[model samples]
Target: MLLTDDIIESSCRHNMDFDLKKTLEALLLSTAEPILLKDVVKVFARYHQELSEAQEAIKGEEDEDDIAIEIPSLVTQAQIREALEQLTEEAQAQNRAYRVVEGPNGYQMVTAPQFAEFVRLLRGAPRPMKLSPAALETLSIVAYRQPVTRAEMEAIRGVSVDSALHKLIELELVIVTGRAELPGRPIQYGTTDKFLEFTGIKELDELPASDVLSNHQIDEWMRRSEEEPEEISDEDVGLSKEPKPDELALDEKFVEVDWQRENVESDAAPEPESNENTPL
Candidate 1:
C-alpha cells in the first residue's frame, strides 16, 4: 500500500525529535566559516533515518502501509530552505546583534555593522602594523584589478607606489604572479592567501563590489578641494615627519656627546688651580 501525503506529513510532525531551525542555528553559530547546504541536508536526513529505524524496531514487522505510517519521511530540500529563510527573518525581527549572511562560499553568521564601534572598542585600537592608507589603496587596486603592473597602478593613482608595494610585499598580502606579455614584460601583482586571511574572506570573489568614482563625483571633490583653505602644513595636521639619513646620523653623534659628558662628570677629576691670589 502507498502512503498518502497527509500520513507522511503527520508522521513527520509527530516523529521529529529535534527542531530544524534551532539545529541549523546551533550549527551556524558553532563555526566561524560559512556552512554549505549539502552538509546541512546530510544532518537533517540522518535524523529522519534514525527516527525511522527506531520506530521500525519498536513496532516489529508490519505491512507496507503500516511501515509507511510508522516511519517518518526524510526532509526535503525545500523544507531546509524554508527553515533557513525563517531563521534569517526571525533573527532580524528579534533585532539580533548577529545575522546569517550569504557569502561567496555559502551562508555565514556575521555581526551587524552597526555595532562595529563597540566591537572595536572591545578589541582595543588597531595594531601599529596595520596597513597605511596608501598601502590599503594599492591593495584594493591589486585585489580588484589582479595581474596588474606597477606602471598601471601609478597611472591610476597618479603617483608612484614603490613604498606602498614594498610594504604590501613585506606584509605578504601581495605577490608577483607572472609577467605581463607587454613590451617590457612587467611583473604582474596579485593578492595572496594571506590577503584572504587578513580580509576574512574565503576567496577573492567574495570581495565587495568596487565603488568606482564617477566623473561628477570627481568634479565635486575637486570643487571641494578648491573651496578649502590652502597653506596647510603637515605639523598643523599632527603628521609626524619621516627622519632623514643625515638627521639620524646627527642624532647618533648627539647621543655619543651626551655619553662622553656623562662619563667625564662621573669620573673623579682634579679641579683647576684657583685665581684667588691674582684677584687679591
Candidate 2:
C-alpha cells in the first residue's frame, strides 16, 4: 500500500532526509553539460514510473521480497536548489578536488581552482587564453545592457566594438538575441549561457552591479540617449575632412600648366633598336 505523498506536519518533529543531494551528485557526474532542475525531476519521475510498473507486476502475487523505494512524489525547483547547496557544502567540508556549481543553465561539477594545474596536466591542455581589455570592456556593456545593438555598445565604450564584439561572438560569450524595433532594426546582442559559465554565475542578475554601471544606471542612460542623443561626427571617430598637399592645385605662374599635351617622345616601337643603341 502506498502512503500519501503529501507534506506532513509533525508536532514534535520527524528526522527526515532525502537522497536528492547524492542523486544530484551522480547526475552531475554523468551529465556532460549542466543539468537543469527540471531534468533532475524528470529522472525521479522516470524512477517512479518504473516503481509503479513493478508494483503492478506483483499485484495479488505471493511476493516475499517487495520492491520498496521512498522519495518525494513531487519535487519542486526549490527542493533541488537546496539539495545542490548541500552538495556544494559537503564537497567543501570534505576538501574535495571538485565542487558543484550552478551555471546559467543549471548545475554542474567543476574541478576546484587549486587543483586546476593537475587537471590541466592530466588533459595536457594549455592555459586558457584571456580576453583583451577592449574585449572585456565590450563584453561588460553587452552583458549589462543585453539585447543591445552594436551601435549601443559603441556608444557606451566610446569606440567601435566591431573587432571586440566579433571576438566575443567567436568565443560564444555573446550571441544575437534578436532584432530591435528601431529605424534600421539593428541586430541585438546578449550574453549566452556560456558567458554565465565563464563569469561563474547562475544568471545575468547574479553579476555584481557596480556603482558606476548598475542596471538602473544603464537603464537611465538608455532613456537619456533616446531623449537627448549626442551627435557623432567623423572627427569624433578619428577622421578628418582636410585635403592633403598633393590634392591642392598648383599655381599657374610658378608651375607649367601643361595638361595632356606634355612632351611625348613618340610611342615605343615594337622593335626600337635605334633608340636602344643610341642614334649616332
Candidate 3:
C-alpha cells in the first residue's frame, strides 16, 4: 500500500509539471511581445495561489472543519527555462515557422529567418523611410544619454532640434518619457523598443562605446581652437582663465561638488550680525 501511494504521488507531481509547462507555453504564444521570466513566474504563482484558495473553499463547504488544502510545488525558474528549451527543440524538430528565441530583452516567439521572404510577400512591399543625418545624431544622443531633454540635445548638437525631434517621434524611434524637474520642467526623451527592433539590437549596452564620441568631440574642439586662438587683452591678465593641463587632470579625480547642497547650506546659514552704525 505504501509503494502504491508513492507511485500515485509521483504521477501527481509529473502531471503538475506538465500542466505548468502548458500554461507557460500558452502565455508565450498568446503575448504579442516577449515576456520576462519574472513576469511569467508571477503569473504562475498567482494562479497556484488562487487554485489553493478555491480548493480550501470547497473543503470548508464539504466539512465543518477549517482544514488547509495541500498546495502543489511552486514552479521554479529552472523549470521554466527547461520547458522553453524543450519547446524550442520541438519546434526545430518539426520545422515550425515560428520558434522561441532568447535575446537580451527576453524570450520571444519569432518567425524563422528562412520564412522571412514569405512573410514579406504576405505583408506586401514595405515603405522606404530613411533616417536623416540630424535625426540620426539626435537619436544617438537620446540613446546614449537617455532621459535627456530637447534643450540638452540642442546643447550637444549646437542647433535647433524641433524638426529632428518631431521626425524621431513620428518614426517611433524616440519617446517622451517624462519631464525633468528643472525650472521649465522640460520633456525628457528616450529610445523605444521599436528602436531596438530597428537596430537589430536587444539592449542599450549593445551599442558602440560611449567614450568614442566624447574623445572625437574633444579632438574636434582642440583642432578648432588651434585654428583660431583667442586674443588675450592686457586688462584680462588678472581675470580667471581655463585651468592648466596638470590642474585639469587633478580636477578630473576630484569629487563633483553638489551645487544644490551648497546652495541649501548658503541659504540656511545665519546672516552675519548687521553693523548698522558703520554701514552707509
TM-scores, one per candidate:
0.51, 0.65, 0.51
The residue pairs in collision within model 1 are none
Q: Model 3 misses residue 196 by how many Å? A: 3.5
RMSD of 3: 20.9
Worst 10 residues of 2 by lDDT: 4-13
True lDDT of residue 105, candidate 1: 63
lDDT of 1 at 71: 58
**Highest TM-score scorer:** 2
Candidate 3 C-alpha lDDT tens digits along 140-195:
98988878888778877889999999999999999989999999898999999889
Which candidate leads the pack in lDDT?
Answer: 3
Which segments of model 1 are wrong by more than 4 Å?
A: 1-18, 51-71, 76-79, 113-131, 169-177, 183-185, 191-280
Extract clashing residue pairs from model 2.
Answer: none
- For candidate 1, the per-residue lDDT at 14 reads 62
Backbone clash total for model 3 is 0
Better of 1 and 2 by TM-score: 2
